[model samples]
Target chain A: MSARDRILGAIRESLGSTPRDTAAIAAEAAALLADPDAIRPELAGPSLTESFAAKAWGLGTTLDTVADMAEVPAAVSRYLAQYGLGPGLAMQQAPELTGLDWSALAPHDTVAPDEPVALGLARHGIAESGSLVIHSAPDNPILLGFLPLHHILVLERRRMLPHLEDYAALLGREDGIPRNAILITGPSGTTDIEGSYVRGAHGPGFLHVILVGDEE
Target chain B: MSAPAPQAGFKARAAAAIADPTLKIAIDRTTGTAERKRAAAVAAFSEFEAARARGKAIKDHVIAHLDHYLETFERNATAAGAKVHWAASDAEACAIVVRICREADAKLVTRSKSMLGEEIGLPHALADAGIERAETDLAEHIIQLAGERPSHIVWPAMHRTREQVAELFAEGHHPPPTAFDPATMVQSARHELRTKFLSADVGISGANFLVADTGATCTVTNEGNAELTTTPPRVHIVTAGIEKLVPSTAHAFALLRLLVRSATGGELTQYTTFHCGPKRPGDADGPEEMHIVLVDNGRSRMLKDEFREMLRCIRCGACMNHCVVYRQIGGHAYGGVYPGPMGAVLTPVLAGLERSRDLPSACTMNGRCAEVCPVQIPLPTLLRAWRGRSWRERLEPSGLRYGIGLWAAVARRPRLYRFASGAGVRLLRRLGKGGWISRLPLAGGWTGSRDFPKPAGRTFMELYRAEQSGKGGPS
Candidate 1:
C-alpha cells in the first residue's frame, strides 16, 4: 500500500477496531461544514466603523474617511502631503480605482521591488479585528499588497462586517474560494530583536486605509 | 560526519541554560512581556473561553474522523488543482519536497517560518538536494545565519541578544549594516530577502491550519513574508502536519481566534491568508503550481495512546510562556524541535521514551501550562502520563527505581514508616547547620544549584502525641 493508504489505515485503526460507516461520516462532515460550531466574538463600540477604526489604529494602521469615491483623489493627495510622500502610486487595476481620474498622480500598473506606495481595494472590512479582506483577481496582483513601503487600501464602509466569522461565512457561501483571500489586520510587524515591536519587517511598514463613505 | 551528540540530557542542558546570563535575561524579558500581553489580550475578548472550547471540539471531531476528512480534503484539494501528498515519516516528507523542487528545476528557494519544516529538517534536505534556500522570517533568518535551531516556536531566536544578532548580520549581509537597531536590522533583512523572494523558484511554507471543506491551507504571519514567499515563487509547497486539519474555514477562524491571542497577544496576525491552489486563470501573479504535503511522523501512533489530547495543540506557545520551568531554562534546553511543556510531553512521544526520558521529568507539574492552553490540553496530565510510561518501561535510572521501591516498602507498613521517618528527621537535624542543609547525600541534583531546608528534629506523629498528652485530651 502507498503512504496514503497506510496513514489512513493507521488512523482508522487508532480510532477503533470496528468498521466505520463512510456514508454517515460524510453526512456528518457536510453538516458540520454547513453550520460550523464557531463562536463569533462580540464587536465593541456602538458601530462597526467605530470598532474597525479603533482596531485599525490599535494595530498601527492610519485611517482616513472620505464622503465618497469622487473625493478619494483629494484625500489621497492630502494624506501624501501630510506624510511628505510623492504622488507616484503603484495602483491596482480595479474598476473603482480606474474610474477615478489619476492625471494629478502618476499611477503605475505594476509593483516595483522598492515601491514606496501602493493602492488596492478591499472586498470587506472586519470590525472586530480591524482587518481588511482582499480577494485576488486578474487585476489584483498579490505583490501589490506585499512589495510597498506604504499600503493604501480603499475600503467602502458599506462592505463592513461585524466579525471575521461573518466574512468567512460569506466566503463559504460564495461561488468559490478565491486563489488568495487575505485578511490584513495591520502593517507588517515583528518583535524578533530583543522582543521589541518593529513595523515593516518584510511587507508594508505603514498601512493607510481610506474608509470611503459612512454606513447607509 | 554526523553532528556530535549533546553532552548530556535535558537536565544537563537545562542546568547549563539556567546559568547563561544572556539566555537568562532574554528569556526573562520575553516571557514576562509575552505573559502579560497574552493575559490582557485574552481578557479583552469575552468569548475566548467559548472559542477555545469550540476549537477543541472541532479538533476532536476532525481527529476522530480523520480518515474520512483526509479523503475529503484530498478530493477537494485535487479538484482545486492542488496536489496532496502523504508522508509517513520525516524523511519521506522531505524527499517529496525535494522531488518537487527538482521537477521544478528550483535553483533557489525562500521559506517562511514553519515548525513542521524544522521538524522535517527541510533545510538540510534541500542542501543535500543542491537547492539554495533562504529563511525569510526575521528570527528564523537570524537563527539560520547563526547556524542554530529555533529556540522558541514563535520567537525563533528568543535566546539571542541584540549584540549577537548584529554580529550575525555583520557576517551574513553583503555590505554590513552601518548601524544596528531593530528597525535598521529589519530594513537590512528586508532589502536582502526581497531579491531572494522575487528570484526563488519555489517557496515552502507551513500551514497554520488546513480547511478540509475547501481544501485550503491557512498560514498566519506577522511579517507578511509568507505572502511574498507563497505568492511570487513559481511553485508553492506547503509542509503541514496531518493534525493541522480543521473541518471548514469557520472552524479554522475559530481556532485562529484563540491561536493569535494566545501566541502573540494579538487579535490577529497582519496576514491571515488562505491559499487554495495555484494561480487561477487570469490571475496576474501567483505560483503556477501548489502542493500540500501531509506528514504523520508518529502522530498516527499518538492518536491511539493517552497522548491523544496533545494533537489539539495549535502551536500557540502559550503553554511555554506560562510554564515556570520554561521561563527559567528556555526552549533550547528541551533539545527538540518543540520546547516547553508541549515539548516535554511531545518530544518523548515522538522521539521515544529511551531518547527523551528526561523531558517528562523536567516539569514541576505547576499546571499553569494546562490552565493557559487555549485548547484546554491537560499538559501536566500528559507529562505525568509520560513519566508513568517511562517508569513502567524501565526507561528511568535503576537507582531512582530502587529509591521509589524502598519508599513504597516502608510506606506499606505504618509502624516501620513512622520509625524510619523519625530516624531520618533526627539524622537530618544533626547533619544540618543553622537550620539549613547546604548539601544532602544522594541529592546532588537538588543541592548543586541551591540550598535545601533542614527538617525539624521531631516527626509529625511524635509531635501530635506529645500535644495530646500535654492537653490531657487522650489516655
Candidate 2:
C-alpha cells in the first residue's frame, strides 16, 4: 500500500472508525471557514490607524503619514534622502503605486539580489499587532518583500483592520487566495547572538511604512 | 538479546551542564529575558487566557479529526499545484525529500530552521544524499557550522555565548568577520547566505501551521530566513508534521497570535507567510514547484494513547522558557531534539517510557510550563502521567521504587505514620547539629551538593493539631 493509504489506515485504526464520510467532512470543514468562531481580543484603542501606527513604531518600523497617495513619492523621496540611501528603488507595478510619478527617485519593477530599497503596497494594515498584510500577485513579486535592505510599503489608512481575525475573515470570504499572503510585523530581526536584538538578519534591515490617508 | 538501555541519562548530562558556568550564564540570561518578555506580553493581552482556551479548542478539534483535515489539505493543496507526500517515519520522510531533490537535480539547498527537520535528521540525510545544504537562519547557521544540535526550538543557539559564535564564524566564514559584534556577525551571515539564496536549486522550510481550507503552509520567522528560503529557489519543499493541520486560515491566525505572544513576547513575527503551492503563471519570483511532505514519525502512536495532548504543541518554546529546571540546566541536557517540560513528557513517549524514563523525573512539577502554555496542555499533569507510567512499568531506578514504597507503607496507617514521622524528625534534628546536615544516607544526591536543612522537632500535623486545640505550646 502507498504511504498515504497506510498513514490514513493507521489514523482510522486509532480513531476506531471505518472509512470516513468524505462529503460530510468536507461540508463541516467548509462551514468552519465560512463562519469562524475564534475569539478575538478586544482592542483597547479607539482608532485603528493610531493603534497601528503605535504598534508599528514599537516594532521598530519608521513611518511617514502622508495626507494622500499623491504625496507618497515626495514623502518617500524625503525619507530616502534623510536615510542617505540611493534613489534607486525596486517598486511594485501595482496601479496604486504606478499612478504616482516618482520623478525625484528611481523606480524599477524587479528586486535584485542586493536591492537597497523596494517599494510595495500593503493590502491591509492590522491594528491589533501593527502588521502589514501583503499578498503576492502579478504586479507585486514576493521577492520585493524579502530582498531589499529597506522595504518601503504604502498602507492606505482605510485598509486598516481592527485585528488579524478581521483580515482572515475577509480572506475566507474571497474566492481566490493569493499564492502567498504575508504579514510583516517589523523589520527582520534576530536575537540569536547572546540574545541581543539585531535588525536585518536576512530580510530588509529597515522597514518604513508610508501610512497614506484620504485626500483632504 | 535485549536492546541497549534506553538513554534517558538526563542526570549525568544535567550535572555536566551545571558544572559549565558559561553554559549556566547563557541559559539563565536567554531564558530569563524570554520569560520576562513573555510575562509582560501576556499581561498586556487582556484576553490571553481566552485566547489560550480558543487555541486549545482549535488544536483539540483538529487533532481529533486529523485524518479528515489531512485529506482535505491534500486535495486543496493538489488543486493549487502542490504535490503532498505522506511519510510514516523519519527515513521515509527524508527519502521522499531526497527523491524530490534528485528529481529536481538539486545541488545546493538553502534551508530554514525546522525542528521537524532536526527530528528527522534532515542535515545528515542531505549530506548522505550528496546534496550540499546551507542553513539560513542565523542561529541555525551557527549551530550548523558548529556541528551541534539545536539547544532550543525557537532560538537554536540559545545556549551559545557571543564569544563562541564569534569563534564559529571565524572558523566557518570565508574571510572571517573583522568585528565580532552581533550586528556585524548577522551582516556577515546575511552576506554569506545571500549568494546561497540566489543560487540554490531547492529551499526547504518547516510549516508553523497548515491551513486545511486554503491548503496553505504557513511559516513564522523573525529573521525572514524562511521567506528567503521559500521564495527564491527553483523548488520549495515544506517539511512539516501531519499534526500541523488547522481547519481554516482564521484558526491559523488565532493560533499564530498566541504563538508569537508566547514566543519572543512579540505582537507578531517579522514575517508570517502563507504559501498555498507553486508560484502562479505570472508570478515573477517564486519556486516553480512546491512540495509539502507531512511526516508522521511516531505522532500516530502518540495520538492513539494518553500522550495525545503533545500534538497540540506549535513549537513556540514557551514551556521551555517558563520551566525552572530547563532554565538551570538548558536544552542540551534533555538529550533529545526537544527539551524542557514538553520534551520531558514527549521524549519518553516517542523514545519509549523505558528509554527516556529519567526525563519525567527531571521536573520539580512547578506547573509553570502549564501556566504559560498557550494551548493549556496541562504539562505538569502530563509529566506526572509519564512518571506514573514509569513507576508502573518499573522503568525507574530500584532505589526510587523502594524508597517510595517504604514511604507509602508508613503513610498508609495514621498511627504508624505519626510514630515514624516523630521518630524521623527527632533523629534528623539530632543529626542536624548547628541547623544543617553535612551528610545523610540514601540522600547523597541532596547532601552531595549542599547541606540538607534540619527538620523541626515536631511534624506539621502535630503542630497543626496543637494549634487547633488552642494550646499553641510549641512556642
Candidate 3:
C-alpha cells in the first residue's frame, strides 16, 4: 500500500471510532506521515523547481534573480530533454506549483508524478525536522517524491519557512486541499558502515536545486 | 598464498557483519532513535549554534596547545593520585594496560562502549591473556553474547531486531524465557551481569571528553553503566584516544551541549560522570587504584595530517543516525568498529588504507554528518581528501581509479563531456524499455533490483547552448 493510503488507513482506524468527523483526522495524519521520498522538483511552464541539496551550512541560501516564466519552462524542458524524464519521471507539482502551466512541459507519455518524471518542485512553508513542507492536492501528488530513484526539487527562495507555523497558515486558506502533505530535504542517504555514504539505497540517487523567487 | 584468517583481517569481519540481521535491526533502531532524538534536542536548545561554536573553539584551542595541556593534565592528575601513562602506539598502550591488569590478577573486566577498545582489539587480547572481558553497555553485551563486533557507535548492536535477542538470550540461560520481550531480555541480561559488574577486579572505559584543567575524565551514558563499571572495580583503567582531552571542565561544559544533542538527542545523558582518581580517603565508593592510559595509536599521526579535524569528534554518533547509507545497509557493512561518518573518517586513519581502502571513497560527501557534528568535524571533506590521498599512495582499487580518472578527464572538456553524455543517453535509450534495465553491467546492483530511466536526449549544456543561440527546443 502507498504511504498515503497506509497513513489514511491508520487515521481511519483511529478516527472511525471517534464521535467527530473522521475524514478531518485522516487528512491531518496524512500530512504527519507523508511519504518522504515522493517529493519532486518540477519544471512547470514558468517555474524552474529543483531538489534541495543538504549543504553543510543549510538550504537557506538566497538566490535573488527574479526569473521569467519562459526561463522556467525552458529550464524544465532542457533538463527533461537532456536528462530524459519521460516515462517514469516525477514533477512533484504541489500547492506551491498549482498555478504554473504544467502542460507546457508535459511529457508525451502523460505519466503521473510518482512515475519518476524529470523533476518534482515542492515548497514547504516551514521545515524544522530537516524536511520540506509540501501540501498535496489532485494536481499536486505526494507520491512523486517518495518512490522515485532520482528526486529533484525547486524551492521558492522567500518561501523557505523556519518552522511549521506558516505551513499551517498556507493550509488554512485552502479547502479540501488533498489533506496530505510531505516534507523532503536532501535525497535520502545513509552512512552506516563506519560512516561511508552510499547514495540511491532507499531513495533518489540524485537531488538537484533550482531556487525560484517569491518576492516578485 | 591463501586467504588470510578472518580474525586477522578487518575486511573479512566487515563482510560477516551484514549477514547478521540481529545486529542490523539494533543498528537501525539505535541510530534511528539517535538521529530523531538529536533533531529534537537541537530543536530544544535555542542556543545550540552558540554552544557548538564555543565547544568547537574550546576543543580546537586545546588541541593547538596540546603539549601544554598534556603536561598540565599529567601534573594535575598525578597530584590527584591518578597515574597517567602515554603510549604512542596500540602495542605500547596494550602492553601498559595488560601489565596493570596482570598486576591486579584481574580475572574479569567490565567495559563500556569505547571505540578505542575495539581499535586496539583489546577484548581479544584480554581473552588471549586468560582474562574475561565483559561489555557493560546493553547493546555491547548483546553483540558480545552473539560473538560479533559493533557496527554502530552509539547502539553497538543497533542492527539486531528484538526477535534475535530472544534467541540469543535463550542460548545461554538454562531457565530460558518463553519469548523475546525486549524489556524482559534486557532485565534478564542485567540480572545475569549484575554480579559480574560488582565482582570484576578491573573496570575499563573510554572517555567522551577528558578535561585537563580538573584532571577529570567525563563519560556520558544514558544507562550510567560506565559509572558503575568504574566505581565497583578494585583497579579502574580509563583508556582514551589522545584526542579525547579538552583543556578544562569549562570546555567540557561547552562540548556537553553538542555531545548529548548530537549523539542521542537528549538535553543530557541520564548520567554524566567525571572520575578523577581512586576513592578519596573518606569516599564511600570508588576504585582503589586509578589508571588513565592515553593511547596515541594513530591519533598523533591523525593530528598532523590534513584530516586532523576528525580528531575533534566527541563520539556523538550523529553522523551514524542521520546517515542515509547507515540507515539502509547498517554499520557492519563498512567493515570497521567505527561505523557511519565518524567511522569512515577514522577507520582509514587508524587501520591505514590497504585494509579499509573502500571507506572514504564510498561516501557521497553530502556534508550532513559535518553539518550535525557537535565538534564540527569536517567528515565529508576528510572523506574526499582521503580518497585523493589513497590514490597518491596507490592504496585504491585499480578499477575505481581508472573509472574515476576517465570520468575526470572527460569532465574537464566540454565537447568530450557532451559526447559522453549523448552516448550514455543513446545507449540507455536503446536498452531501456518498460521503464527498467534488468542487467546493466557495472551498474547491475542498481538495475537488478529497480529501474534506471533511459537518459533523455538532451544534456544540460546542450540546452544552454540552444537557448544562447535563440533556438527553443525542437517541437
Candidate 4:
C-alpha cells in the first residue's frame, strides 16, 4: 500500500470506524471552512488606527501618519534622515507606490544583498497584533520585506482590521488567495544568544509604518 | 564524533547537570527571562484563558477528524500547485526530501529551525547524500557548529554561554570578530547567512500550523530566517508532522496567539507567513516549486491510545520553562529531540519506554507544566501514566522495583509498618550527625547530591498517639 493509504488506514483503525460517515465529515469540513466561530478578544474602545499604532509601537515599530499617499516619500525621507541614512531605497514596482514622485530618493527595483532600505505596500493591517499583511504579487515582491536593513510599509488606515479573523474574512472574499501572504508584526529580533534580544537578525533591523489618512 | 551516549539514567544526567555551574546559570537565565515575558504577555490579554481553551478545542477537533482534514489539505495544496507527500516514518520522510532535492539538483540548502526536522535527523540524511545544508536560526547555527543536538526546543543553544558562542564562531566562520558582543555576533551571522540564502538551490522549513482551508503551510519565527529560507530558493520544502494540520486559518490564528505568547512572550512572532503553494504567474519572486512532506513518525500510534493528548502540544516550550526538574537539568539531560515535560512523555512514546524509562520519573509532579501548558495538556497525568506503564512492564531498574515492592508490602499492614518506621527512625537518629544523614544504605543517589535531613526523633504516628493520650504535653 502507498504511505498515504497505510497512514489513513492506521488512523481509521485508531478511530475504530469502518466506512465512516462521509456526509458528516463533509458537513463538518464545510462548516469549518465557511465561517469560523473564533473567540476573538473585544477590541472596541480605540479606533483601528489608534490600536494599530499603539500595538505596533509596543512591538518596537516606529510609525508616521500621512494625510494622503502623496506624502509617503517625505515621510520615508524624514525617517531615513533620522537614522542618518539616505537616498537609495529598494522598493517593489507596485502601482500604489510607483505613481508617487520619488525624484528626491533613489528607488531601485531590485534589492542588493545588503540593501539599507526597502518599501512595500501592505494589503491590510491587523489591529489585534499590530501586523501588516503583505500579499505577494508581481508588483509587490516578497524580498523587499526581508532583504533590507530598514523596512517601510505603507498602509491605508481604512484597510486596518480589528482582528486576525477579520483578515481571514477578507481573504475569503478574495478571488484567490495570494501565493504568499505574510503577517509581519515587528522588526526581526532574536533572543537566542544567551537570551538577549537583538533586532535585525537576517531581516530588517527596523520597521517603519506609514499610516495614511487621518484618524476617525 | 557521534554524540555521546545518553548518560546512564535521568539521575546520572541530572547529577551531571547540577555539577555544571555554567549550564545551571545559562538555563536559569534563559528560562527566567522566557517565563517573565510569557507572564507579561499573557497578562496583557484579558481573554487569554478563553483563547487557550479555543486553541485546545480546535486542535482536539482537528485531531479527531485528522484523516478528513489531511485529505482536504492535500487536495487544496495540490490544487494550489504544491506536491504533498506522505511518510509513515522518519526514514521515508527523509528519503522523500532527499529525492526532491536530488531531482531539483540542489547542492546548497538553507534550513530554518524545525524540531520535527531534528527528530528525523534531516541534516544528517542530507549530508550523507552529499547535499550541503546550513542552519539559519542563530541558536540552531550555534548547535550545528558545535556538532551538538539542541538542548532546548525553542532556545536551541540556551546551554551555551556568550564566550562559548564567540569561540564556536571563531572556529567555524572565516575571520571571526574580536569581541563577544551579542549584537555584533548577530550581525556577523546575518552577513554570513545572507550569501547562503541568496545562493541556495532549495530551502527547507517546518510549519507551525498547516491550514486545510487554504492549503497553506505557515511558519512563525522571530528572527525571520524562515522567510529568507523560504523566499530566496527556487524550491521550498516544508517538513512538518501530520499533527500540525488545523481546520482553517482562524483556528491557526487562535493557536498562533497562544504559541507566540507562550513560547517567547511576544504578541506575535516577527513573521507569521502563509505560503499557499509555489509562486503564481504574476508573482515577482518566490519558490517556483513547493513541497509539503507530512511526517508521521510514531504520531499515528500516539493517536490510538490513552496517550493521545500528547498530540495537543503546540511546541510552546512553556511546559519546560515552568517545570522545576527541567529548569535545573536543561534539555540535554532529557536526551531526546524534545525536552522537558513534553519530552519526558513524548520521547518515551516515540523512542519506547525501555530507553526513556527514567524520563517520567525525573519529574517532581509539581503540576506546573500542566498549569502553564497553552493547550491544557494534562502533562502530570501523562507522566504518571508513563510511570504506571513502566512499572507494569518492569522497565524500571530492579533495585527500584524491589525497593517499591518492599515498601508496598510493609505499608499494607498498619502495625508492622508502624514498628518498621519506628525502628528505622531510631536507627537513622543513631547514624545521623547534627540532624543530617551524610550517607545511608541504598540511598547513594540522595547523598551523592546533598546531605539528607535526618528524620525527627519520633514518627508522626508516635507523636500523634502521645498527643492523643495527653502524655507529657506531647514533647
Docking class of 1: medium
How high is the lDDT of residue B211 in model 1? 84
Supply DockQ values for each candidate: 0.73, 0.67, 0.01, 0.69
Q: lDDT tens digits, residues B342-430, model 3?
A: 89888887777877777776566778888898877788888888777878898766887789899999999978998989778778777
**Deviation (Å) of A187 in candidate 4:** 0.3
Off by over 4 Å in 3: A1-216, B1-27, B470-475
Candidates 2 and 4 compared by TM-score, better number? 4
| Candidate rank order under DockQ | 1, 4, 2, 3
Q: What is the DockQ of candidate 3?
A: 0.01
The reply for model 4, stretches above 4 Å from the true place, is A18-38, B1-3, B7-9, B433-435, B471-475
The residue ranges of model 1 lying beyond 4 angstroms of the native Cα positions read A17-38, A172-175, B1-7, B430-436, B460-475
- For model 1, which pairs clash? none
RMSD of each: 2.4, 3.4, 25.3, 2.5
lDDT of 3 by residue, A1-216 (tens): 632233223333422333544355334423422332222112111321222222201422212133543355555555566666663344544444435656665532223323454355555523332345444434543334433555555656666653333343354355522222333434443332222233332334345545566443
Question: Among these predicted structures, which one has the highest DockQ?
Answer: 1
Candidate 4 lDDT over B93-113, as tens digits, reads: 999999999999999999999
Off-target runs (Cα >4 Å) in candidate 2 are A18-38, A172-175, B1-8, B431-434, B465-475
Per-residue lDDT tens digits for candidate 1, residues B1-475, read 1111355678878888877788889888788889999999988887777777777887888888888778888888888899999999999999999999999999999999999999988998999999999999999999989888887899989888888889999889877777898789988899988899999999999999988879999999999999999999999999999999987787788788899999989989999999998999999999999999999999999999878899999999999988888888888888888999999888876778899988888888889999999999999999899888888899878889999999999999999999999999998887788978888998878787777889977999999989998999765
Whole-model lDDT per candidate:
0.89, 0.87, 0.62, 0.89
TM-score of 2: 0.94
